[model samples]
Structures are given as C-alpha cells and as structure tokens.
Target: MNPIEARHWISAEDKDLKTVSFFHLSFPEQRAAFEELIQHTPAIQVYDTIWQQLQELMKTRHPAEKLSPDLLQQKAAAHIGNGPADEYGVWVYYPWSQRLVHILDEAEFVEMRTSRNQHKITAAEIKTLAAKKIGIIGLSVGQSAALTLAIERLCGEIRIADFDTLDLSNLNRIRAGIHNIGLPKTTIVAREIAEIDPFLKVTCFEKGITEDNIEDFLQEGGRLDVLAEECDSMDIKILSRQRARAMGIPVVMETSDRGMMDIERFDQEPQRPLLHGKVPDDLSYTTIRQFSGEQRMQVALNILDYDNISEKLRSSIHEIGKTITTWPQLASAVALGGAMVAHVCREICLEHNIPSGRYYVDPDQLFKL
Candidate 1:
C-alpha cells in the first residue's frame, strides 16, 4: 500500500493540465493518516463539501448506515475540511484532506449545475481553434457559468475576475466550497478551472472590474468572442455592455425568473439598446434608471400580487441580494439554466450565421428557446 491510495489530490502540473490522484496505503497506515493528518475537523470539512453532492446520488444519502462500507471509504479521501463540525452544517476543518469546505445549502439558496451532453462541445470547430479568452466577473453566477464552460473544454483560455471570496452563503449559487473563503473569487475560480481541465488556459483578474480598467480588463485576451456579464454590479453591467459593443463583440446576459432563463443578445446591432447604450439619445442615464426602476417594481409586484406567490417565497426574496432577486429558483434550475444558456452562447459564437437573439428556458412551465 502506498501513501496516496487512501486520499485524493487535485494536481496541476503545467499551464494546462490537472488530475486527481489516489494512492495505495496499508489500511492501518491510512487510518493513521486519517487520524493524524485528516483531523475530525478537516474530515468533516471534506464531508460537507460533498454532503449535498453525495446525497443526490443515493449512494451517499444520510443516516450513515445507508451508505455501503466501500462508499464510506471514499468519504475519507474526499474530505474538504480539517475536522468535524460541531453541528450538522457547521464545521472548521477536515484534517485528512486539509481542505476548507463552505456551507451554502444551510441557507437554502442555490444548487450545483451539470451538463447533459459532454462530447457535444469538444467536436465543434471552436475546440480545434485553440482556447478562448473570456473575463468572468463575480463568483455567484459567474462561477457556475465558468465551471460549465471550463468542463466543456471549449475555450482555449478563460480569465476570471472577482474581488470577493467564497463563503457559506455563496454555496447556494457558487461552485466553490469553504476552503476558498477570503481567497478572492477570481483566484478560486482560476484554481478550480485549472484543476478541472489543465489543457485550458486560465487567467485571473482578482482586483475586481471597474470602468477605468474595463479596456485593460480584456487587453490580455486580445479580441474576445464574447463578454459574459455575470457580475452583480449594475454599473459594471453598463460599462461592459458599452465596451463590448464599441469593440464589436457579442455579449450574453441572463436573468433567471424562478426556474426560467432569460437571455439578452447584443449580437444583432448596436442601435438595438446595448444595455446602457443611448436610446435615440433622448433617454438620459437618470431617465433610464428611473425606467429600469419602474420595470423592476413591476416585476416584484407581479410576483407578489398578480403572480400570487406565497409570503414565504416573497420573504425569501428579501434575504437575497438585490441582483439575485431578479431571478430565483431551486439549485437545479439555476445550475441547468447557467449551463443551458452557456451552451447556446458557445454554439452561436462558433457557428457563424447562427441566429443571435434572446432565449429562455423554464423547467416548471417547460419553456425552452
């Protein structure tokens, strides 16, 4: 038995390569490593990282006894923390893995997203063209979108930019776990993407995005095929829209209404309201803000009164950040929505003459475009 057999390690060797390694070790030696290195805290941390993930598989479902001994064995190697949690969802460590796992589900916020078709992307012309350079802003939706794109291995390069780090609250929507806390969203995202597909290039913009640096923001990538607007900042959205249009690149923006996905395409023509672009120069920024406010109010009112949403659901919205409230759903919807929208965006970019337009998907009502 070798040392690593009892544990798993996500390793990055070169500019574009990552792999998970499992080694062999005597069960007794492994137990010692688990006890000495993977403390209860870290062990718990690892467990929490995949708690929900395992639960979804039926193999790792709760009550502990339900899991086969062989399956439980895998848990020790996958621990995300340094020790055991004092409670079900709270933890500080997982010693064996020596990793930090953030808790987001305790808040009942978001879910992890996955793709149905794996090979559908790799066969496209985009893959042969080398990787792409995309700057992702924010870690919430941005993280999910980045992970989906990374796993597809479509783009040759991806640049992640975000000042914030991972927290338990973000688990609802982000792909990162607790160890990434205070790690800077961009850094964690880059690290995760690199770990996922080493062959794909990942760059970081950890300082966050701003209008002053917007041009320099994408300078590293040279010309971009698309600008993904996933950041929650309204100001950044406006600036990105303008920069993308001025440079003649397509931009993809999505708003998830409960389980619904709403995509905005700037690929058509500049005159067609490029987010913050002038509307005939008659609508000033102030006026546009006012109009946007009214529209936001209308949406809220519809959900509250006309839509007949329960007070519990309505109250849940108040707990969310202003940006997320624009769209709400279970983890499944958010994850699927992010992947689906990204799938289409990648398709449109690679297939010249592909129709560029707004599209939506709602699992509940079965809306797909």
Candidate 2:
C-alpha cells in the first residue's frame, strides 16, 4: 500500500473504536455478520462467558423467589427463548482490539454489571443517572474524572475535549501508556471509556474548546448536565464557566493541588460570579488571553487563592523558570481528584444539594501528625 493508503487505514482503525458492534445469534443476518467478522479477522480473541453471567443475572433477579439451582438454570434458558447456551446473549466485537466478547444484551448486561451497586445506587438512581450527560475539558486530570465517571456508570453520555496530544511527561498522572504518545488526549480518554463500557456514548472535541465551538459543546446535542473544567488554559477556564453560567449548567473543576475541588452551580444561581468571585469583574477571557506568562500565573494563583495552596505547590510555582518547566502534579493527587470530581458530578446529576463552593480533601491536613 502507498503512504496515503496506509495513513487512511490507520485512521479507519482509530475511528473504529467510536462504536461497538453487537450480534445476536437469533438473527440470521447478524449471525452471518459475526461469522464473517471472525473468519477474516486473523488471530481474533473470542471470549464466551455468557452462561455464567446469565446465571448470575438470574440470581440477582430472583433474590426473593428462592429457586433451586436447576430451576434457576431453566429460568435463564427460558428467558432467552430456551436456545442453546452457545447461541445465547449477544456477541460484542471490539474492532480495535480484535476481540469478540460474548455477554448479555444491553439491558441484562447493565443489570449484571451494576448489580453490586445495589441499594447504594438503587435501581431508580441508576435509571436516573442513565439519562444524564456530562462534558469535560482538558484531559490531564480530566482523564481520571472521565474514566471514574464511566466506571461508576454515572452518566449515559460523556463529551470530552482536549486538543493536546499525549506526551512522555503526561504518563506521570494521565493513565496512558508510552505507545499512546502523539495521540490526542481526547482520543485516549474516549477509547478507554469505550473499552470499559461500550454502551456509554462518548463525543470527542479534537480541536478543544474555543470561542467558536464552546456553545456547540455545551448545547449542540443537549445541554450538559455538568461541565468538568480541568484545562490548563486560563482563558478557556474562564470562558467555559461564562458560557456554562449563561446556559445555567453546573461546572466542576479539580485543581490536583491540596485535593481542591471547585463546583460552580450555575444552574442554581445563574448570576453567580465566576470562581466564587475569585476572578474580578474586570477580568474577561479576551483580557486574560493577552496577559504575559507572569501575568497569567498571577491570575491563576489569585483564582486558586495563593494563601490556600499547599506549600509544595507554592514552592514549585517559584521554580517554574529555574528548576521546572511547569507546575507539578502527583499521580496520587490526580487520582484523588478524579474520584472526587466523579462523586460530586454524580451528586449533582442526582439532584442532590451540592451547592456552589470550594472543598478540599487534602491528605496532609487530614492525616497530620
């Protein structure tokens, strides 16, 4: 193949991960498609564990029915039309990985996969969360937030935006491998979410959020239920909240320092000042965009509250030009931020009273001697 053709092939493979294909053996055309796919895909890994999953589903469904083991097996078989066990459930094909996973259909799959959530999440809560949509910007710390949200099945759809590509330096906090370097941060996060739960919808904004596309990101498909702003761009940070407040959508941000998490409930108080009024009224996106490097850092520090930042971060900020090129973030802090953001987003989506505020989960302060 020519260079152009090879590039096209690689692009097609990358795009293939955007969706998953499912085949139910009960349908003749679908069965044929599945057979053809496996036949042509060399060395494809096939996994068949539908029978055990079905058994578990049966146990979950009839916890109070008290059926015998044999009776439960018969019930599982009967629910899927008493078909052969081999032909049961649906076959999920992951084209990027060349693997076919045999599992329950969407309904049963979600039921069994989230069964452990139980009374903690409740069936009603799960259904409610399934209807929510979340938007995230800046995939460094945002990567953790997105993955944690997906793993928890917090929302039905997630829209992630990050123009920056993965770098060797990103591996310290971003959960990506060396091979993913040069790939867009949005793509890495989206592909990881797809792998975890193919049923969840993920939209990627490869160009990142800009003045031209910020509106579309927040309202095009549907108004975002929550916006997680974690980008490094100060201008975009202020711009996103401005737009989100105008649209009355809530925004959440994790600074990865002192375990600081910021939630701006724009939906609750549409007129609320940005960053809880940390940003002065005179400061606008256009003005901030023109600031010099030192000016930008000062503005960011002021927004984050210089007095509240951890000592390590304050020291690191001083070392930017001398010892370090930028601010330092630990994997531990990033991971904690991801979980914190996910929890806060979940609460907001569920209509809980998570008011606009700044909270910290600092380990040093919590576990001090």
Candidate 3:
C-alpha cells in the first residue's frame, strides 16, 4: 500500500482503538508495517455510538439524581456486550452500512428500538406480538407487508418463501434496486428485514412452499400466528390456505388491484372458506397449474370482484401474455396493500375485531362522482 493509503486505513482503526498506531514513513517503509497490521488485527473497527447513547440514556433516566456520567458509563459497560452486542460489545463492520457499528446488546437494543412504539402498541400488546411468528409466502408484493411488519415490530419472527429471483420488471411493484438483480426474492427480503432489526428472527424457504414442505412451513417446528399469502402460483395459494386453516392460523392476502385486501380468521372461524369461497374449496392444485389462458382470466375475475375493479385494470387482464407480460401493478397499489395487510396482521395477532372479508382501499371509489 502507498504511504497515504496505508496511513488512511490505519487511521480508521486507530480512531476506535487507543492502542493501535502507525508510524509516519515513506511509501515503501509503510507497506511492510501496514501489511503486518492487516494480517494480525483484522477485526473491523466500529464506532462506540451505542456506548455513547447508553451513557446519555442514563443521564435522562436519573435527571434529578444527578449521577455522574462516568459512573453510569462504568455500570453500563458491564452489561453492554452481554446480549446482542457482537460477543460482548465488540464492534463489527456491517457491509450494508459500509461502516463499523456497535451491535447493541439485545435487551438494551429492544428497549431503545421499540421505545418509539410505546403508546401505539402499549407495553402489553408489544409483548404479545413479539412472541408471535408470522409466515409470508411470495416476496414480491409480500416484501412490502414483511417490511411494514418488521418496522412496526409487529411480530417476533418472520418466515418467507419465494422461488423467483429479482427481475427488472418487479421494480414497478417490488421495492428493490438494480443491485438486487438476479438475487433470490427471499434473500432480498431477508436482508432488508435483518438490516432493520437484526434481533428479529427470519427464516427463508428459497425453493418456495410445496406440498411436501407446506406442513412444516405452517406447523412443523412452530405454528404460525398468521399467514400472509401473496404469490403468483395459484396452486400454492390454495394449498397454503388449506394448511393454515387446518392449523387454525389466520390468513391475510393483499391484491395489488383497486387496493384490495382479504382477511380470513380461520382460527376464529375454522369453517371459513378460502378467499371467501370465491373459488371451489376442493379445487385441485394440478387443475390450477394447468389452467389455460382463458381459465386463468376467469379465476382472476372471480377472486377480484369483476364489478369493483377499475375498468382499466379489468381490460388490462385480458391482455396478459399478449400486450402485457403479466397483470398490471403499480408501486402505489403494492405499497398500500403492504400497509393494509400489516395493519390486519397486527389486529389478528392481538385478537382485534378484524372480520373475515374483502376490503377495498380504492382512492378512486372514495372520490367518485
């Protein structure tokens, strides 16, 4: 490394650790020394932001006590690295951030992380959702719902399934970037959730849900609190509902059309039919997979009430595989679906009175003549 480059690299490390140092030297002399340091102390240097924050928090917690900041820092230091911190408060480099960060220990992290959610979730409700596991199928539109749930801290864990990879076409609806091209949809969703809150457990089904794995996906290890079904495969959608119903797990689905969303409280009403009995309960998976062009269009019509969908979207459905590659979708509609489904998920998990039915968030309808 050149003298300037080596010094720049060494200085970053030195900033975090007081003992680490580098001698100013010529390019040639610095090369050997820099290489040695790189070989030996390879750990990434991270800022002590969490430590600083915790100290500040202590001051706020005891405003009238007037405790010494140094004393509080000393007390907090012992508890800092014990939980979520990287092996006891050790700093690590995060690729996404491209910077070093102190992974706050889990408890402190939770306290600070969900502090903003206080009046909204309440301490009791937050605890309820934190212990629940949510299963999400298909990461394209489901990406929005999963992200919304994560941001709200609505569930303790999330399981996602998607066999498809990120394609440029998905950008119109799926929240992703060109850098995510060709990556598995599940991977992108998982990374997004982890970046938001590393403590939340995330499980991925890269191959997508299948008959063989469907059972385990729903209740093999731990049953899901709610199932958010959003996938292109007609068969998987039906099959997932059957499994969720059998396991007494409530189901929620968002259709990126007319801002429509469906909620099925199968847990509360076990006999409740899938999609409000829009299609036959006994519809075989094989039959759906082999659905002809016209048959698929009819199914779409039945699922999304023909009368309620905008005329433009209704006409666009007929052009699938001809003028259009697939059903038309907009980022606005997809994002709205995500937020709506997230709200329903929280409601169902908390045993709120979210009835089983189809609801529309159509802005056009609301402002109609």
Candidate 4:
C-alpha cells in the first residue's frame, strides 16, 4: 500500500486498541510473558517505582507513628514475602506507548494513589464510590469528565461511547494531542483512564449510543449508578434520559455554554419529567430524528432556554452559517463543564440531595463585580 494508505491503515487499527495489560511476575506464565515482551521489544521503556510506592504505603498506614528507614524497609520486605522488588507486584504494559510500568498490585496501588483524598473523601465513601458504575455518552466534554472521574478513582467501572474520531477541529476543546487525530474518541478516553489506573474497568461503545444499543449500554453487565449525557445529538440527549428514567438511574448533562448543568434525579422521582419538563413527553425519538435543520435548532434552543444563555452565545446563534460554522466552544468552558459533571456524578452516586433542575456555574456572572 502507498505510504498515505498505510498511515490510514495504522490509524484504523488504533481505533480498535484494547485496555492496558497487566502481568503478575509472581506467576510463572506471566513472568515468561513479560520476559518474552522485553526480548522481542528491545526498545520498550521500563519503569520500576514499586519501592517508592511501598514507602508511601507504609507511611500512610502508620501516619501517627514514626518509623526509621531500617524499620520501613523491613516492613516493606515482609509485605512482599522478602522477594526481589521487581517480582513483588504487577507489571503493566502499555502497547500504544511501548512502555512497561512496575507498580504495586491493585489494592496497594489504589491505597497509595488516593491517600491524599483521605478526609476529603472518607474511607467509607471511597468504598461506596468504588462499587458504583458510570456511563458517559459523549467524548468532547465527556472526555474531561471521564478523566476527572478516573483521577479521583470515583467509580469502579466506566462505560464511554462516541462514534466520532479525533479531528483537528476538536483540538480546540477536546483534551487530546494532534497525534491522536483519526483515533476513535472512545479509544482515546479509555486508554487515558487505563494509564491512570489499569485496575478500573472501562467499556467502550465505539458506535456511540443508538436506539439498538442504548438499552444494553444502560443495563448490560449492571445498571449504571449515574449517566453523564454530553452528546450533541438531540435524539440521543432525549432518548438516553427516557431509558435512564425507566431504569431509575439519575442523569446529568453539562452544556459548555455558561457551564449550564441539568440533573434529572430519575432514581428518586422515576416520574420526573425529562429535562424538568422542558422537553415534551409527546416528543418521540422518531419525530425528533426527522426534524428539519431549522426545526432541530429551534428545539435545541428551547431545551437550553434561549433567554438564559450568555449574550455572546445568543448573538453567535444568528451567525451559525455566516461568520461561524457552528456553536462555539472554548477549552476553558469544556474543562469547567467536565469538573461540574464529575462533581455532580459523585454526589449522586453517594446519594446526596442534589435536586432535579437546571443549574448554571457561569464564571462570567460569578466573577462580575
């Protein structure tokens, strides 16, 4: 194949990439596999930070008591059966980056990584959050939310969906590098989460959420504790909520404009109207799918409440096909939206009393004199 075609072929393969692989060196078969990986991939970069992590783990376990260097070393040695440091824990391999990391096993690694989140996120709360599963439907603002959720180790499993691949235009708001262009958005988010904590389960629906698969996405394996709906598709925005309400799963959405966040506590009030009744119950996905471009735009505006939008965004709406190609989104807004969604998701999973309604965290208004 020509070089150009070959490049496209490689990118397509990347879209099918899987989660990071972990091998426990204590097992003979896994050790053999690691040896084979290193032998064949001579240039693979290896990182062994297990010793440092062990030190941190020991300190966290004995915060009130002071242990000397020798005592700490002895404790660490006993914790790992006094085996060679390299063979004590799991070795994770990242195929995309051709790098290998040696770190503590799942439980120990998680303890050390989230030790700082102690009082802020209590021990009982951590266990409760870990058992929860979250589903995210879009990859633009959803990317930021997924990362924040992963970093906080807020959920044990995350299901992400997006049918689009990375493009140059997405660089303005999506948190991805140019090298990722053409890779599926779901793949990018899943891979990043794996790098953060390989033990966390991530399921990717590369096809994005559609009528045929929406049910499985919400109910398969286990019902999601919360759903973060950030997709722009009007049908999905409405259809997903309909399904979530039926399953009694709460739904949270963040529009980058003015950091507008909408929460539908369907779990608490299964009969809560979709979008706080902003969307008519009579409106079906079938009808929404066939709406003309102008009609669809009008529906979207109604959902967002045009009167409440920032003046600049309201003005930009008229220039859709003139000065701009579509609605404008800035990196700052997307990042803020991610944090907002994550914070709300965590609260909902913890059963906090966040009511069903629309809330805005507009920086412009907050910072105004």
Higher-scoring candidate on lDDT, 1 or 2? 2
Better of 1 and 2 by TM-score: 2
Would you list the C-alpha lDDT of every candidate in the order shown? Answer: 0.51, 0.85, 0.75, 0.87
Residue 316 deviation, candidate 2, in Å?
0.5
Candidate 2 local lDDT, 202-279, one digit each (tens)? 888888989999998998878999999999999999999999999999999999999999999999999998999988
Q: Each model's TM-score? A: 0.56, 0.92, 0.80, 0.94
Q: Give the best candidate by TM-score.
A: 4
RMSD of each: 12.6, 4.5, 9.6, 5.3
Model 1 ranges with Cα > 4 A deviation: 1-126, 258-268, 276-330, 352-356, 367-369
The whole-model C-alpha lDDT of candidate 2 against the native structure comes to 0.85
Q: Model 1 over residues 1-369: C-alpha lDDT tens digits?
A: 654331112121232222222211224454454445445443343434545543443332344566665665466335434543222232222232345343322222111221223245343454443445655666566677778777765566666667676666667666666776655666666667644443456666656776567787666448666667776555566666667766766776554444333233555665556443312223233333455655544533532243434344566666656655443444565577568656755765675464444444545456535
Q: How do the residues 266-337 of candidate 3 rate in per-residue lDDT, one tens digit apiece? A: 999999878899989888777888899678667767877798888889898778778998878888888988
* Top of the candidates by lDDT: 4
| Model 2: ten consecutive residues of lowest lDDT | 1-10
For candidate 1, what is the lDDT?
0.51
The reply for model 2, stretches above 4 Å from the true place, is 1-14, 64-72
